[model samples]
Target: MNSKKLALIQTAMKLFYRKGIHAVGINEVLKVSGIAKKTLYHHFSSKDDLILACLHYREQLFIDWFKQQLDAVPAGKAAILAIFDALDSWFNNRSPAMGEFNGCFFINASAEYGREDSLIYAACQQHKSHVRAIIKPHVDAFEADENKSNQLTDSLCLLKEGAITTAKVQAKLSAARDIKPLAASLINHPLRQANI
Candidate 1:
């Protein structure tokens, strides 16, 4: 995409991430982004298309940042802790790419765009699955059985979601750190038999 098109996506994403998908209007995006309606329509056929573009844009950005954070730590329990650590910075708006998080953008968008068939909702699901993919490697190493690995990933994902939700609601980004202990417990569980 060209600078103007990318700018529109970024602007709209920030607005949608801060507010909500339905709460934000096309005119508001255009006005805030300083893009003309004709140009926006030229780039995206409709508001929904624009929203999808923004989701795609954000999905890439979010995953890249998340992977970077995960990479900073070795693949082990520390790697899992790295996720909550990253969430701390993200919730606190410490990342330049992410302003003060209203919550997980995908989670927020999914709540509003709940219809199973909606592209926006599908994008949300895809983003979450991508997150799981990123996390699976760390969890997989801790569990020899495939089913146990999947279960571990699911548990970790829930802890992450819970941490994000708690952080947002409690008005303290550090609240996400609470997940660390629970995560450690899961990682060090007796049944796992793997060194965390």
Candidate 2:
């Protein structure tokens, strides 16, 4: 991507994440990025196009960061639980790469673009699916039954979403840590029964 286009996307992303998609105007993006209006239009046909690009950029950055955090811990159940620890760090503003916590960007996008058929909404949904996909492998590693593994993955994803939302909405900075015990129980139920 050209430097101008990348700059526009990055600027728009921070603005959108910090504020809301509808709240930030193209003019603001241009001002923050120091890119010309004509250049933004040259790179993106419309503001919606730029919004989509920003969403894509945010997804890749977030996924890469999330994967790295998971990889730092042991895999399987331990890694799955570490997700909350990662989220705690993020919520506490410890992870500078993720920027300040303003709730999940995808969640914010979905709210602004509530229509399910809209491309922006779809992009948000895709980000969520990617999150679940990242958790699935860890769940699978610990749960042998396919059905059980799928359920476990769903539970973990739900917990993650809850943590993000609570941290943002309720201003509960320890939301992630607060929810960790529930996740630990969910992930270790079988092992506990077996005394493992």
Candidate 3:
């Protein structure tokens, strides 16, 4: 996209993440981005449109960063366990691209847009599904059975979501680390030994 549009989305994302989407108005995004109202209108038809774009942008940023983190480690169980280490970095504000930890952006968005059929809610769900997909391959490597792998993937996603939520709500920076052993146990369960 053009520099102007990218600026609008990034600025809006930062603001929307720091504050709620409804709490940050279009004017603030315009002012922070140093772009004109007409320009924002040219890129996005409405605030909701911009919000959607921001969500997509955030998802891409997160997915890319998360993949990089996973790639740095060996695949299979190591890569799976690296997820929490990555979350720990994120919770500690080590991810510059993601900004400070205020909680999962998708979770916050889902809370705001609670209606199941809404595009915003759908976007949030899509983000979650994408995250689960990313973790599936690693789970598959360690769990041969299709059903077991699917269940393991879902369980890992739950642990991830719980870490994010706990880190945000309880202000426990070690939430990811704290939950890592449980995840390790789940990965190393007796039923999964056949694949390993």
Candidate 4:
């Protein structure tokens, strides 16, 4: 993509994420991005196409950041905690400075698109499975038992999904703080140890 198109996509994502997808329009994005109409259409066929590109870009950026955090922490339970650690940074800085401190981009878009065929929906689905895979290795590293990792990955994903929704609806931005105890409980559980 050209620098202008890339800039437009990046700016649009930030705007859409901070403001709901429905609330944002092409004119607003164009005005904010300061990109010309011909340029925008030359790169993106339509608003839907642009939205898809934005979603894909956001997904890639998030995954890259997530992987970097995981690498910074130790493997297994320690690495799993890193996910929460990264979330904590968001919890700490919930304000206009960083834009909307709402919740997961996937969750927001999913609610908006309702599992439809839109690119946002497809990107959301792809992004979620990618997230699960990222945590799979850490879960698998728990003990001698191979399956425990898969189980742990599921449990962690559930916890994450709930956390995102709960934090958004309840206005408890620091909700990730709750995950530590839950994660610890899972890590130190008797059934998990017994399986090994």
Write model 4 residue lDDT over 137-165, tens digit each, in one string: 78777655666656767788888778777
Instruction: Give candidate 1 regions above 4 Å deviation.
Output: 190-196
How big is the positional error of residue 52 in model 4, measured in Å on the Cα after superposition? 0.8
- Each candidate structure's TM-score, on Cα atoms with residue i matched to residue i, is 0.94, 0.95, 0.96, 0.89
For residues 1-196, could you state the per-residue lDDT of candidate 1 as single tens digits?
Answer: 6999999999999899888888899999999999899999989999889989989998999999999999998997788889988998888878876667888888888899899999999999999999999999998776777877788888889889988888877776777687788788887892662333
Kindly list the per-residue Cα lDDT of model 2 for residues 1-196, writing each as its tens digit.
Answer: 8988898899899999998988999998989989889888899999899999999999999999999999998889989988999999999999998999999999999999999999999999999999999999998887998877877788789899999999999999999999999899988895442332
The candidate maximizing lDDT is: 3
Off by over 4 Å in 2: 190-196
Model 2: weakest 10-residue lDDT segment is 187-196
Better of 3 and 4 by lDDT: 3
Worst 10 residues of 3 by lDDT: 187-196
Candidate 4, overall lDDT? Answer: 0.79
Backbone collision tally, model 4: 1
Query: Model 1, 151: alpha-carbon shift in Å?
Result: 0.7
What does candidate 4 score on TM? 0.89
Scored by lDDT, model 3 comes in at 0.92
